[model samples]
Target: MQKILITCEHGGREIPEKYGPYFQAHQPLLETHRGWDIGALELYKKLVAAGADASFFSETSRLLVELNRSLHHPNLFSDITRQTAEVEREAILEAHYHPYRKQVENAIQTFISQKHSVLHLSVHSFTPELNGEIRNADIGLLYDPQRNTEKEFCARWKQEFEKLDTGLKVRFNYPYRGTADGFTTHLRKLFPDEKYGGIELEVNQKFPQGDKKNWEKVQQIIMQSFYAAVK
Candidate 1:
């Protein structure tokens, strides 16, 4: 049996209360798409309530230290905190970054050792429009094309979504590429295709950022699609 592990990296826009003073001037940025994934957390909650085996999240805003980005990644820190002294940055890594990654890595190893392949679904949300370009997908299932498991899973997942809501625009890879630098990609190096399948579920912010009724509707559709696909 495969076990599902759900994670929402940029779930909250909260700057730790201790770090609040450092982010006072950057309040506006904290609420933008740059701060946290707009609706990823809510979707994550829905997934958990729907029976995901495990779920993890960071309540701290991504602006402090991006959870998705690698430590050496250029955009790991937002403009506001990037210039902080090395000591402070290291503190953030110790307090926030390392622990999350370690916990996830350990969890995957434990599961795989128990004879169950692990499916990691990292939930995220993207802005409807970036720069002047309008994003064209309602939902995007990102996975490495080179991995047969990833490729086949996404294709069936997209078909499941179509079955649930035929009008929904489910894109293969959009807003961002799956193979690009990120947490799941990082895990691919550590876990093989047979033991681990990592996928990032990117939902356009338009759903949860829009009307409450429609957002609830979409969430239902997502769970229904999951059940259908698994069947």
Candidate 2:
């Protein structure tokens, strides 16, 4: 049996009460793309409603501690939190990071133990334009190039997207490489390809940042195309 697991790491820009002090002057930054993936939570919710076997999300602002990044990654703790005492940083990880990751890991382990193949979709959004360059794709399906299963599935998904709407450009590993330091990359190390297939679904922020009606339409198309792909 194949099971789907959905995760949205940067779903919201909520600063914890204790850490709110650090972000008092940085509210503007928190509202920006750097703080959270703007439309990721809504998209993830849509996926959950589409009958994912399991789903997990974190609303804690990435600026406090990047949930998608590994502990050792330099960007794990943003500028504000990085300046904290070493013990404080450890406490933050213990409270926010470990629990969320452990929960998802345990869920995947359970599914794998049942001899079920798991397809983990880590949902995220990228700014429409970065560094003055416009990203060329509307949706990006990222997976490790070396993993044939991941590669093949992405190719199929892209084709499905095209069938749904050729106008909606879909690309492979565009905004960011799948092998980079991320939660899905960490899970890939723990779970073998035969058992776990991890793909990061990247949507262009333009849709959510634009007209509400168009955003809703695109989201519905995404859900439909995804269901078609998995089948």
Please list the residue runs of candidate 2 whose C-alpha ends up more than 4 Å from where it truly belongs after superposition. Answer: none
Model 1, position 156, has a per-residue lDDT of: 86
Mind giving the per-residue lDDT tens digits that candidate 2 earns over 109-176? 99999999999999999999899999999999999998877888898888888888889988899889
Prediction 1 TM-score vs. true: 0.97
> What do the candidate models score in CA lDDT, each in turn?
0.88, 0.93
Task: Give lDDT tens digits, candidate 1, residues 1-231.
Answer: 888888999999988887888888889989999999998888889887887877788878999999899988999887877889989889999999999988998899999999988888899999999998999999988999999888888888889898789888998877789999999999999999988888898998999889999999998888778656655
**TM-score of structure candidate 2:** 0.98
- Stretches off by above 4 angstroms in model 1 are none
True lDDT of residue 144, candidate 1: 95
